[model samples]
Target: MHKKAIYIMMLVAVLLASCSSPGRKALELSDNMLKTAPERALAILDSIENAGGLNREEQLHLVWNRAMAHQIMGMSLAEDEQLPEAIIHYREEADKQTDSYLLEASYLNWKGKRADAINVLNKGIGKIKDSTKRVKLMAEQARLLELQREYSKAAEVMERALELNPTKRDKAILNYKIGLNLSLAGDPRSEQFYSQSVRMATENGDTAMACEFLRNYADYLANNGKYRQSNNVYREISRMMPQMAGLSAIQMAMAGNYINLHMPDSARICNEKAIESEARLEAKGFDDISRRMVIELERCLLDYGDGKPVSYVGLSRYCDSITADMHAKESTLARRQEAKERLQWANHELRLDRQRMGWMLAAAVLLLLLGVAGGWIYYRNRLSRLAEAENSIDTLKRMLKETQTPAEETPEEKQQKSEDDAFFKKILLQQLGIIRMVASTPTNHNQALLKRIAGISEGKIQTDSLLVWPDLYLVIDRLYDNFHNRLTERYGNVLTEKEIQIACLLCAGFSTKEIGVVTQQSDATIYVRKTSIRKKTGAAEGQDIVSYINGIKAD
Candidate 1:
């Protein structure tokens, strides 16, 4: 009875192996097309099509594989600039005996039948039960709409694609496409869409896409007369992709736009930056684009600043020609056709080889299953070993953690940290008070207060020793002198130097503790001086001490 059961099991396994379809073989052929080995791919696909005793599933797979081979060949021809010939092969594959709506849609889309492309995609979406495949079809349709310049419709379709479950990469692309459509539509809400795309790209860690978003945002800002903001955005672009050759040209263009907005200083700064970048590129022998950009920028600067108009006849013409030549040599499809064909052919051969090997893999898998069945008792032994290893790891980890010691903080260390924190807090409060005081005063008072604040913030202050109080006193005296000079310039004959110092202390809006820390004076003395200064400055009712000081301005 045991022998009979073994024989029956072996027979069932053999029958199942025989029933396996040629799908993997077809996939291998399809992969060859990607490697530009179209002839080899076609040969493998033809062998599959001619293989005898194939069931319906195997026949369908073979047809699909053959279609892929043709599609790859068409791509190769397109790369060779034989567009019409490529289209012919693409059409042939589209009409092949296959149920792959994706392949059909792709071919139709490339053939410029936009409506037919969308129709084929819709059919695929309806017929495909897999959520992943359905979303892919929707994305393709949305891309087609975008290419047709139907931006609103494209955005709506992309929204639907986003509704479907997508990988992070797909979501990023979807957001970018939506932003692009919104921008093309010229809607004010495009900024929000672009921002969303930027966030998505940043999350995905796609530096190139992030740079592109920054460039577009900068252009938008410049067009809207936000020159300073646009310059900031361009700076971000330069920081992100310093080696990008086009940035020099972009910076120069932005500088010219700044000049148009009457920001000559900013324009000069941008122009200088572009010239520096171009010089660096020239030094590295990557100066083709950079050199041209420098010339154009120099011309623009002269035109805007020195009354010399830019001439586009000689240098511009040459620059455009060079750009065209470089583009043709790079990622252009026409230059890569031969490689594409070879890849297709290799993929097709690999498919047939895999199909033959599939039976061997099945036999190995069956042997593995038998080993697993016989080793059930040994499985427990393996688990015991794993458990022992894990326990050992846990013991080592605990020991490591216990052996580690955190450094102890000294008294001076703790005190320094506290002082640093307090210093930053004081700075923050002082800044807020200055802004509020300046905003609340009259125009003349506002100018005087701004000048005083600028003086205080201009240079670094030295605080070397807490024991040497004279250094601290010197810093305070210097700050007071600056305040007095600015205040005297704006408000003449209103307050004496002593009163000005007292008024400045009041206008700072400091608490008693802060005032003592800043001025090296007692809180009671500060209060007494403030009262005396207020009386001397003005005797009006309902006037705050800070307001009274700001109220003194020369006509």
Candidate 2:
């Protein structure tokens, strides 16, 4: 028996030593990798991989680390514009392991053969059973689909990914991707989907994703004439991604929506940002679509700044200059000319009125008399309605105040209430016993117990003032009874209510003032109560209140 026990102890020690060995090595490697040369890190990983007699887990870890190093190397090459070399390294890393198919897909996609990359991913998805891995692959596939302008298909892929992994982290990314696809699709139903995605992303703690979704959602809402919601979403996006290029231009486009919603000040701010973002985009050599968007945003800013309704002629000129679509630009210009001609014809008709002075003078005198009579009658009716409403509101207010007051109870009634309270306390204790039997387990029912106690206490005390007393012994008794019973059931013995309260107060590491606020007692009184409770409970010296509470169980 002694030899067997010694062998077991030795085995346990060996296992613990082995566990400690890898953790320290991993930490050391991680710390060195942060400051060490990349080539050196790669060499170390390569040595580990080639080291004979290593276990399968160790070999896999080495392979994973080397792959990460290669990926970082490829990214640096790409950033330096060495695409061919970057592609070679990325492809080599991807080809090293069958488990890392997503990396391979990314490499192929970036190499400009998107279809081939997606097919590779499809094969891997069929083989992988892990839902998390599958979800990640699907999201990557959706991103590729978005780049290809297959918006509907991309949305479908994102939805499938979300269905596979309903965790908040996954949901946030999925919703943002879906919103992006819908925004590109330009369908009215896209607005609804984008809004839902923005809300989900925000709830899931993905602020960056939420910001991206809100930006797209705002654009969709503005286009659909939901200006108020669109403007609000734009403001949120601006606040989140203040440094994002083209943000000001996007906000400028949204300014028109804000103005239409009767928010000129907000519109002006949006317009200013739009102009600034556009200037930044120009400096950065933005694409033709982005340039055209900036020009339109600038026109909008100018129109709003000048306090004029955006003129069709000015809009047409602006659109013609920047729009890439020849046919659309021509059509807009033609419409503007037609509108201008119509306005001139109306103005010309008004000019003819200058020759007919005698008839115009008589008509103006009669119109003035009619206006004066109508204004007087309208003002009198409005005043009468206002007076009636005021009187009705005053009567309702008085009735409400009367209903809020409590009825006064006599001395005999007070004595009867006192007798009733004692009877209810007995009934409450019996009910508590019933609850304990029903619960039959340690559970988080403290709030439920409090509710039951409050009901019982209310039955005893008829007056609100009595019920809300600072030193309500009945409430404390009920609270203690519930906690003590649960603790006893769990542990066979536990601290009394006063002891638990005192220990919790002390253990909470709170000041006397804080304890007073929590317990609704004065600081001096709380200190006194804590002292008495601690002495009765016999808590160990220097033990924390939280630790003591944690130890107790109502078994």
Candidate 3:
């Protein structure tokens, strides 16, 4: 028994020492020929695979080494511009390796395989340990997030990457990306990152990127209504990149800024300079199509300024239609390029193949139909109630308009305005008092009768705006001077009573909310009414209903 134990111990010791030896030898041979003849080294690796001398840990190391070899093979192929072959090798490397997702995602990005890159990054990013590798993966992930339009999430990821990039130039690049994502996310701190990025790029002697950053900085200032400061930055851009192409576009923007600042005279002069610059560009061999478009746009604005409404509207629609077509063509071209490149990508290519086009199309159509049906039902019911109230008010307003005439205001006109405003506030206060009296009135019949006698309507009081608001609508329409006529003209009778009420209140600088306080409607119900009002009034994208309402002129 003692002799047998000694023999087993000696056998185990030799096996343990030899566990990783054979794989190491194979790896060393592959590494030596990596710069010279890699295929021969790969063949040596194949030969040693079945020699069966490696333990589990050694097998892992072997995979790591093999992944490195495949990466080198891909790099050489890429150097020769053999992109498809290179991508295939990169996919092979990525499949065998577990450490780096950045390398895998880069090749996928090269092939425009964004979904495949997302999958690879999602799988590998969490397991990464090396700071550099983790940083690269985070940055790539942020780019993918941006493509998905998850701008805030992308900014967060870029912030993490920013922490890992210690070098000034690298951090500067990351900071620029952070600013881009934050700006798109509509965060207020986007300017801070933009400033940091510009400072760092200046320190790194990258004048080109710094100038680009300054251009955007100027745009931020201009968008926030700071025209003089924005012009200062624009002047800085000219000093930096004197020969920069497309500076004429900035002149067009400056013209817009002047228009917003209520300086149409200055706007006209700036627009002339823009048109001249664009004409110069056309003379210097630039395409006439772009310059012609700019000229047409300027002409449309000028027509509006010159009070040629009919011509301006027609030309504006023409310009919009042509611009839409151009964008559609550009989108189609982008899709074609993406599809072509996707065909060359081979990483986990079958993962997204489960759903067919027919299935996806059917599912999408079903969802769209259901959504349209639900939306139509909701809006139909909501609008019907609103239209009823407005119809009653509209009849009264037509009578008022027929009686009134356009004339210079007298002191009686001013007195009527004050008296009407007082009456409107008194009615609103009385409405609130009625609601509170009804709520706080005792359940006893005599007490409720007393409340009802006091003009509270008691237990029979209507709380729904659709049920009780028609009277209130007529009163508000009559009391608010010129609200009904002005709103009808602006939106062409599309404004419902609820929307008109909101608009009148907003014009009066009132924080309009639920009509329950004034006409017994629930806050949520009124909010839905406001949403429908916005859609019907054609509020511009990103504009809130209240802002649109407040912009309506009462006179």
Candidate 4:
């Protein structure tokens, strides 16, 4: 009887293995097309008659490909009904591979369906049994919450992930993520997690990751106004990665820390080293011209700090050039991203044509012709816009060069320029305060404050009866050769009234603190408003907002 039972079990095992082979092969074929031709990949996945024959891992792979296909095709999760089959398979093995759910949720979040993404992950977390898998889902959930700016809730989710006792590497990464969210949430306990992450990563022999964690720790310290400690961390990183490619970044950060610490000599030395390293990197084909401009600006700051003569026009040119480079890079990046999306959609349509060629040949031909026409029109419009932008940039650059230190200026011109420079300096100082505010606290209060600032800037709310926005506008127009009217005419539609107000403030010599006091709000509120202004203006990171605003030439 025992011999007969063994024979029967062996025969059943052979049958199960044979049945799974076709499903595995189908999965492999679909996987290859997931990236470039995901619509076809989905069709192949749909053709699989029995996913039940595949194991948990294979089932998860199928679902992952399916989810990715739906994402690439810009289809909602609800459109792909097969995505949930993997979750329904083998309830006992549910914890084995849950990454599909995470990927699906990520796609949903990217589509601005953040609430749906959270719900999907919550469902997965409830279904998952094992600690490791559950933590993976929870970690992703925490990440999504972070994007929603619910930093406190993100920290809580991360804490729950930690309670599950993840693997060593996972624990290290989780600790860093938790610290990041906690820090963003303005919780002091973030320091503990940051330290723990560094220690854990170092002990795990992941020195690179440890250094990365240490960098974040240093940034957090610097952000919280602990310059000395932040520099210490930077020094430690310097020791760890002495010959690293990113040495210039570390040195530049150290220079800023030293400046904050009121040590100009040390700051200058660090700045010089940063410039040297940057030059070396540039020689090695690093195309980040903006960083070099930033270093030059820092040098100007150092010179000014030492009571040396600093050419204001030269500084203005540098600011304008940096802002231009930033705008170009941003435009290129945006176009490239859109191009990729269009390519994916094109591939999706091609696959649909092939599948329906026999029945809808005439319709497919008509749609193809329309698509080509539309694409051509879009391409032409894009080129025209790009040409116009380039022309505008060229005109601005020519204006700056032409305006540079004319040989003989009238007394009125010199006084006006000097006043402009002074106002620019005031705006620069105010912007520094605004940047600091952005770094410190990013909360709901800041959001409300942004709206309030916008209201005041747009003239919806009057802070000063004597100098309402329109009155201030006229003052700016009279002072700067109708700069207010010209700026409005040029960027009136692109910039909100609030942004126009801030720009006027930049030109009018209003300090950030003065704005804050007048608005009856904190500097943090103004920071949020200033950040929005920067985005709308497309100003480069670390570039002078005042310079960018004032450098605009009416077309």
RMSD of each: 44.9, 38.3, 43.1, 46.6
lDDT of 4 by residue, 1-555 (tens): 245445544664565467567678888999789888998999898766556557778877787678777766767666545555654453334433476677668666766889999998998899778788889789889978888899999989988888899999999999999899889989999999999999999999998999999999999999999999999998888787776534677878888898888899999998999888887886797736566666777777898999998766754765687689889999999999999889767777775665466336545644565566567667877786555444433432232233343434558877676667444433332332332333464665576434443444334555554235675576668667787887777678888876787777666655665555445345687777788777877888667776776677722
Q: Over the stretch 430-461, how does candidate 2's per-residue lDDT look in tens digits?
A: 33332342255344755554443333322332
User: In model 2, which runs have C-alpha deviations exceeding 4 angstroms?
Assistant: 1-99, 206-208, 235-250, 256-269, 273-555
- The stretch of ten residues in a row with the least summed lDDT in candidate 1 is 458-467
After the best TM-score superposition of candidate 3, give how far the Cα of residue 76 lies from its true spot, in angstroms.
Answer: 21
Ordered list by lDDT, greatest first: 4, 3, 1, 2
**Angstrom error at residue 248, model 2:** 3.1
Query: CA lDDT of each candidate?
Result: 0.59, 0.56, 0.62, 0.72
- lDDT (10s digit) by residue, model 1, range 188-252: 66677767777888888998888788778777767666777877777777788876634566668
The lDDT, on a scale of 0 to 1, for candidate 1 is 0.59
TM-score against native, each model: 0.41, 0.37, 0.38, 0.47
Model 4 worst lDDT window (10 residues): 392-401
For model 4 the local lDDT of residue 176 reads: 96
Window of ten residues with lowest summed lDDT in model 2: 461-470
- lDDT string for model 3 (1-555, tens) is 244445544655564456447667887787687558766766666655333446654454445445445555654212223333333344435343333465456556556777887788876666665566667677778888898899999889878777775577778878888888887888889889989998999999999989888878878788777887877777777777887534577777677777777777877877787777776875696634564565557656776877875254544665686689789989999999898668535322442342245346556755665566666667876686565444433432232233233434559977665456545544543453533443566657445534343222221344342233456556656666445555667775676766666655454333333233344344576666667677888886556665565467632
Output the TM-score of candidate 4.
0.47
TM-score of 1: 0.41
